[model samples]
Target: MAATLNEIYNARSIALIGASQDPNKAGYQVLKLLLDEGYEGKVYPVHPKEPEILGRKCYPSILDIPDAVDVMVVAVSAKVVINVMKQAEQRGDVKGAVVLSAGFAETGVPELVEAEAELVRIAKRAGIRVFGPNCIGMAYPALKLNTGFAPGIKLIEGSAAYVSQSGAFGGALLMFAGDQPCPQGFAKFGHIGNMCDVSNLELIEAFNNDPSVSVTGAYMEAVKDGRELMRIAAASEKPNLILKVGRSSLGAAAAMSHTGSLAGSDKVYDGAFKQCGIVRMDTVEDMTDGMKAVASLPKPKGNRVCVLTEAGGMGIVSMDTIDKTDLVLASIAGDTLAKLEETLPSMAMICKPDGYIDMTAAVSPEQQAESLRLVLADPGVDAVLLMGLPPIFRDAKDTAERISPVAKEFDKPVAVCFMRGESMAEGRRHFEENGIMTFDTPERAVKALETLYRAAFRNGHPLEDLPPAPRHHLVEKAVAQGRNLLEPEAVSLLADNGIPTVDHAFATSSEEAQDAAERFGGPVVLKVVSPDVIHKSDAGGVKVNIRSRSEMADAYDAMMSEVASRVPGADIHGAMIVPLAEPGTEIIIGMVRDPQFGPTIMFGLGGIFVEVFKDVSFRVAPFNEEVALDMIKETKAFELLGGVRGETARDVGSLVDLLVKVSRMAATQPEISEIDLNPVRIYERGLAVLDARIILSCGN
Candidate 1:
């Protein structure tokens, strides 16, 4: 059981169990931070040896304290932590605890692990939520409570709540708050180490509910329940920025050793995060900076942004970078263009109707601010990127002040890039202090706006909540059979789930293969059907475009012989023959059961494109037609499907329908672990599943 966030953060009385007078000890720092931060809550220092500490009488234990303690801070040795927690548990008034000690389960020692477990058991029995047996702890700037041991740090007042898995990282982020520009400082900071009781999801939910906390940032190595996190993220309107590490094999192992957390499949995490509208950040710097920007600005209504720069080269650079992202150069509105043309100097050029607003170096800070004000007011533009304005001119501070009021007036986002200047630091500080997001480069400013636009779009059009998939009996029957499904069986299962599959007939022998090919009366594709074989092509078990009995017979014999040589002990389960469909673009639809996020669906250009380009897009299961369409468009090769080079467009609606059905099947059928429908040819009006391989879970 976990204690409510209110009990932990808004506690009226807090007790520091091992409060010390020594300057070197963490306990001493914790007490000093609480007092120095101007915490309004009652503080009790429980130390047996000290008569008084920091001008306050020290109690022997939590029980000895005269008043009730809402939260207890335990910074003691591993040997005595259990006893301290037990005493707090017996006190009954302690609603929650922040344990600042190590050498527990993370040490991988049995006795220490048992000791931590016992501490948790006592806390749970006593109805007290615990933060960590090994963590830096929590800091609530709004309450002026600093329970962690980072010295000489002043908490910032901001709307973004950051919770980190690593205590040291959390401390660093908090310390670096002076560099991050926000209207206020951070709403709160937490280091949820080990998460034996209170989890990251709970902390996220708490912040999500806080009206003041507009955005939440997390540095999570792993999550205990990905589904719950997704659910909470989906339900909350607040944007979440997450920097999820431990993606590579080496990083995963390191994360496990560091926190005893299993960093699950990175692909699944990506899909789930996108599905739930949580913005996935690439690095801690990105997360921290992005959260600051997102928390301050209004959600851009669209991805269209207009770049304003006094320097022509900076404008060009900003436009080039914006082109690479999901953002687009917005078309300037006629009225806004007219206003710019009237107000600008003769040398100024409103050259691009879409994207860049070129106000030459001759333009003053006042003219620049006016141009920005008009552009931000334009209906076509959702956001504006001010590049190299104040930095180039000597009046950086005055320019920032001039632009600040206009930026705050508009509902859209405004980002500024200080390319270079002697007053770079002072100008940025001024702009940030006045509520404008400032970046060092044009590219970074554009990148921040792109992130804001994406978060806005996702939040507006959220992922659909699909009902539980209807029972799939075909899948149940296949799982009952103790082996992976053959191609024919996999195709049948797909068809049963309303996903279109090619018509096919199975044959056990060469003569039967010939008969089956003859039945098709045209060129047919023949593939070896073996549950034991995963990659049939690698084993030479596939032969395509067989037109006659002789060819079919030769292909069958060659396939069997090749399989025998390639995969010696594999069991042969006959062959499947289907009519060769018209030549068209190929698409690959796949599903993999991720350990943490359950099923995830993938779509990409099939055939060699999948292998050579590796351009694929993934989304969590239960996705709808709209989501499937987005997945299809996310691929780099989407232009090929959209009738590139004067080619006729394939039936994209049919492809989308197929993707949705496959997603449903994956979500509903836990027995099926992986499904690969490769080279699903898309013709003028229809598509055919050329091949399918579905592997059942061994656990089933």
Candidate 2:
């Protein structure tokens, strides 16, 4: 177990090693900030030469402190970092150490790697938690702690706790409150560089557990332990916003499997984050913007939003932005509309169904407030996006004051989008200061509202703790063969798991293939069984619609000869003789082993569309039917499954069942690294797996 964050963030007595009087040095800067930021704790500056620094008595070493040190902030040479830990171990009172030097593992030197490793080993033996050998350390405004070396970081006290892998970015976020238009502030901040000892997961767990932290934001390049992080995030109901970097095809080229090739590890991260109820942000600005909304407002009960704008054009823009998100314009109730009709000016054109109630510029601020309250009272309105507040009737601050109390009264999210102007700056601040989230644009307001709604949706529809999947003996037997499974074997694996598959049998000779075709009594398909051939058609190893026994016999011989000619020295394992599947919507379902996040399931349109359109959705494995249904619904091709062009809807419930079972199989069988069932025929009655490919792990 790692050291708890309480020891690192709430340390009572911090010792700054190599403390200096020179203002240019990092030691002087850190010590000065600690004092300047009003850290309400004892500070002991340790330096061998200096008797006193930063107007505080200096000690030569950790042993000379004459008191237990809760934290040791080291800003000395990397070569001496180990000695500092040794001193910390000798004193045995230092519970945590934050090293602010860069010449460790990041330098790619063997000696630095060994030195960093030694630092962790010593700290582990001493039961001392370590932050970094190359980091800016941490800061907590609520506790009045500023251990980082950055200057002029306005450490305002609020509820969002930020954790970052990049030390500079972490320090930058501490200054975001002063730079950005957001009103949210940090409760705690940490920069776990190198992560040689303590990890981002531990800090997130601590911050989520903190009563003062209402939102947790993380900037992570990679996760240390994917499973543990997933478990922790899944268990926590708090809103977590993460901005993950390194999402690119260049990084994805390292994958050796088809599933990995199709969707990179980034997609795996996406699925796992969603499974654990963590909101993923695309950029740093989005993460900070989202955190501000999450910290300030209540979680929305639903996605239905009521748009209230002073200008007609702004109301339309708000509706357009909301339409692009998961949020929907709420249907105004008749009674609410009648109430608005009676209360508003005669010119007020309120159309709840169309999504916005335009109060026009002629209305007073009081009228706008009253109109908003009336709309919020409707049961259909889960939240409201108010925009176009101007200083024509009343000052921006006065308007903000009148509308701010309405959010608390309704107990739902109320986001205001004041048109950007110098005059509206005070209005925005007043709205934010009074506990209402404010945005500069309508689209931003909708984005914030969407975040709040997603949080609420996840909280309401938490993932079910599914029972473990039963074993599939056929899969185990195939794995014992020490190679990827043949198509027939893959089909058998699915069959054993209660997944419906086309009638199929492996025939070693043309006579057997003929007999199998006769038994089918209709159109049959002959596919060469070669684990090496991912695409049989490309190698001339597949013959479909063989209606007669003689045709089956002839096609079998031709396929073998063509495959032998096309792919020389291939390990041909006979051929699969199966009945031809009926025409229906084709779908693909597969699971890929991500280096992180374990097995991630993917569903999308099958056949050429799978590659051409790339319409797909993903989710982590071991999910119940509800999640499976959602995974299917998220795809752009879902409308086809729902019966487009006046066609009958396919058995979506059955498909969901298949998805759930596949998830179970992937979760239960560790040796099975990948499962691809492409071109699955989805009909009005049921579904059939036309082709299957299961890749086994080398471990078996």
Candidate 3:
């Protein structure tokens, strides 16, 4: 099958459904822009009454046209959109439809929503792919096609593509981009209006294969299909940038464990981005700045960065910002430091902390170029960030002309922060036109360098796009009989998934409890087995350290009475008696079905304070052993697990194996909705699941 977007964007002939001669209407603007921009494809204007529009023959309807149309541009009102589509579907030759009409599902009206659904059914029946029912449409600058009504702007040709969920904001940004003195050009621009049909995922999928697109960026308020997006982004050959909103609406799932309360949706999205190797931008400014930087510069060879500045204050600010990012200051080599000392004036400071140099405001443009050349040549430096605040005596444009050529000579990435605002416009423009990433602030420039390093690292070491595994066997019976699972059952679930649980047995009566304890031949713990008691300790349902059979029986009787008094009318089930587990570093491993992203696994410090000190990390599931290790390293508990203050290293290998198994179970089993394995003690050579709680999907 043909690429749906390719058919629409590169159509041989187009039928403009609501083309008009009136200047005020969007119909007129869309047609005029297409014709004026010199779209190579044939245009057939379709209007109700006009015989001719914009010097082209106008048709009453698509059916009346004699020739076949490759694409249909629908610019009609929502009231008659169904009728227009019905008529076009009869033609059967239209391959794609750009439905630029409004008044569909976005209005929250029942009638329009029904009409939108009907429109989708009609298009699919005729084998026609739909773009949008409430969008401004798309623009392909490289192909000279204007299927959108964004007016008065002509986008220059470049290798970047942008997709937006908000139509008005998207078009305005594109328009502003096209109007700049040295605008960042784009290959394609699309707006997903209501996402009735095609979305950012489809567009990104199409762009991933297209050779003309080098980088892709989007302005998304939300995503409907995060799984597909994650898959596409991880496998992408080029860099992907996203400005995802909804940060202020951060909230966690209202489920039954620390996993649900700590794994906020926004933080999960952050983890997903990192997992898929995507560059996340925070604002429109970031989107534009990031796109330009990635499209223009070669990625850094490594994370080590060197900062060169002509002013002391700018150098200080640049070094401070670099410390906050993954990019580290390079340790300038001895040869390079000696060269800098001999070449610079006495006012210059050389490598105070590391890979930073401050040549005072009095340095000439020639000296600036020489310093950049020497720093970039150092084997320790992977990239260079140059900053300058031109004084009244120094010429900004002259400095740009001198440094731009030298910056380009090295294959390493270069990000320049040229301050003093409009006074340095000439210098900034010089750098931009010469293909150097330039920013107005030191922080922004460092961020660009960081993007380069991250992209390069991911490309060299790509992650596996693991698919969902077969359903785990334990999930079958758990869903059928669901609730806060009993201790024996929950522990069985973990053991079945290749995890080790302490030796345990279930007993209904006091004599049975004593017999079960004696079989262990050591101290044991007794925990009540009742679905009603969600937190056993809080409900007085737990008693530990029973050395004798008499002590076990007495403990069991007293616990039952205490639980009955605390939780009135609670169903009193029997007790699970298990041998006492050896103490070690306690950690939590959890799985919760995220409403949007699905099956996010978490790891953190555990044992009672799991909720209080929420030092946790999350990863969307279906990952491999390497990624599982990444999840563990992301938390502060990693240091403790490795041993702190001369303590022996716990069994990190055993914990990693457990995490991988839990991840597999989470990915394949849809019925096991949430799981909490709190205080899974990690011993020197092995680990044990001390307690487990799994909440099933249904069983109300």
Candidate 4:
């Protein structure tokens, strides 16, 4: 990865390719913004038609420019972009080029894609790093250099660097950040148009090493190299916040059209994010707010919090919100409680939030200040939440000023939530001006606190090595057969990989079925096995819990009759008889090839609840134990697996092990298209696969 925009903030000069005299064009804006931002570096505008842009002399081409340009901004048509890039490569002094044009692989046009590829090849050969093929350009606020068409009058000087795939979305977020009370800064918003050579992962790695950037945030439609992104994010010392769009089918389609990216399933992305310890947010607001909170707030020693509120109702709401955030309300210590009692009348209760603070007690500024001091001094409290203070008391400004110094003494985070409109406005302004974090609502305050809390706990766990891929006995034959494996065959294949499956034998006739049942055990299960009868239960092709040979024969006959009636054209493979397996718990583990993300593994509660509850978690193939455990815990089934109502806990350890094995198998074998292990029975001592289906990839 090359140095990020922040690392090269002191670049001596920049060359503007396709510079134009027309102020309305993006090229003109690029030249104008650089000048307006007070970039100290010399600016060279390369244009064939214009001799001067914004009163600065413009050269006809890069070859004509006397001084070496550190960075070149290519804002030209797609047809001429290649030419501009070629000229940039020939320049010995140019270190990097930002391609601000759009026509690339995103158009899904063959010529444009080929052209973009050639541009990358040229840059690589010349040792010139390329930023984008379709991007809005770049900006470095610290140096007052803006290479993009978008102006930066609203941008405030801060320590966070942002990157995005969508130029408009980046601009919108920058605009939104301008309105926020906290001072937000961006080294540059690199709109990585089509990510021809430079990718989000590379940028993240660069930012991770950049000293100026204290925190990093990204808004991505899709990740080109998910594995690399995970690695960088996991290793980053600074907080990495991500707001990924295109999780839904409709959104994924839009992302594909916008960036020529294949946005993967939401579940897969979620699992990857969790494993990487990236702070994931749903909206831009959350992303901005989360970044601000993580950057500005002091880390809480613990989740314990003390809520100080004037109104009882607001206190209750605050407590409820706190509970949802997984933070514990600190119990009022005896000395702190005594100090509060001394400051207030008997009517004022000083317990937690709901504890007493009399509203009509004619509170004085000195008394209010003293009460806040007592709360801050409490050894039991790690943080304090002051809520519902009306502006009428002292204009909220004076009150905040008086309490700010005392709150700082304890070195603890203090969040304020005002219910009244005027009070909130006054309080927010005062707190922000004084660098004291405040929120409009208790929920928002709790959310901010939660981000910090999670970041603290997210001490990156070491990535465990995944077990080697399991060997399957059925892959070669199934591929040769050019057909999906039946349940019996699939089970046999799984059994070969050390997966436990019930002992069973294929019976060609009713007499054979009875003989097989007696050979296996007296009590056995009979199921009509055929490739066409995928859903045996739906077709009434399965019978279980048979006690005798006669019962087994009857079940065999009934299963055959039901299959024949259900699908008259289907060929009967014959009945399978196995000893009745002890049923403890049921779970499902399956695999399907995702068009964008390749092999994906799914785990959930087995049977009817699988669809009804939609309780499933997914992870991309070749996952370690930690990743597999994260997937298992993501589903509501985790509660059941943990043992509800005195039930013995299921073998979650074994289940995760099995999932890891399956994921590796999927990753190693391209011939396997889909693998379904439904209703795998979990016993007290062991596990048994009751059914399976393996669908080979087409032409395998």
- Candidate 4 lDDT by residue in tens digits, 352-426: 353334332355556666787887787777777776566354667776677677777777777776653654566
- RMSD per candidate (Å) reads 4.0, 2.6, 2.7, 4.4
For each candidate in the order shown, give its overall lDDT on alpha carbons.
0.80, 0.82, 0.82, 0.73
- Alpha carbon deviation, residue 193, candidate 2 (Å): 0.9
Better of 1 and 4 by lDDT: 1
Model 1 lowest lDDT segment of ten: 254-263
Residue 26 accuracy (lDDT) in model 1: 85
When summed lDDT is taken over every stretch of 10 residues in candidate 3, the lowest stretch is: 459-468
| lDDT, candidate 4, at 137 | 56
State the displacement of the C-alpha of residue 654, model 4, in Å, after optimal TM-score superposition: 3.5
lDDT of 2 at 185: 70
Clashes of each: 6, 0, 0, 3
Tens digit per residue, CA lDDT, model 3, 1-700:
3237777777888899999888988788889998988988899999989999989999998888899898888898988789888987898788888888999898889988898999988887888878888887788887788788765557678888888887777786677565443677888888878787788788877877788888888888888867777888888888888888886322433445678878877778877787787788877767776777777788777999988888777777777878887889999999999999988888888898788888777778998899999998999999998998878677788889999999989998888888737788888888888888688788888887887777667621233445655644455555555545567888887787778888899999999999998999999999988877778899999999999999998999999999998888887779999889877999999888777678888899999878888888877887777777877898888999889999999998998888888877777767677888988999999998888888777732
Error of 4 at 223 (Å): 1.2
Given candidate 1, what's the lDDT at residue 41? 96
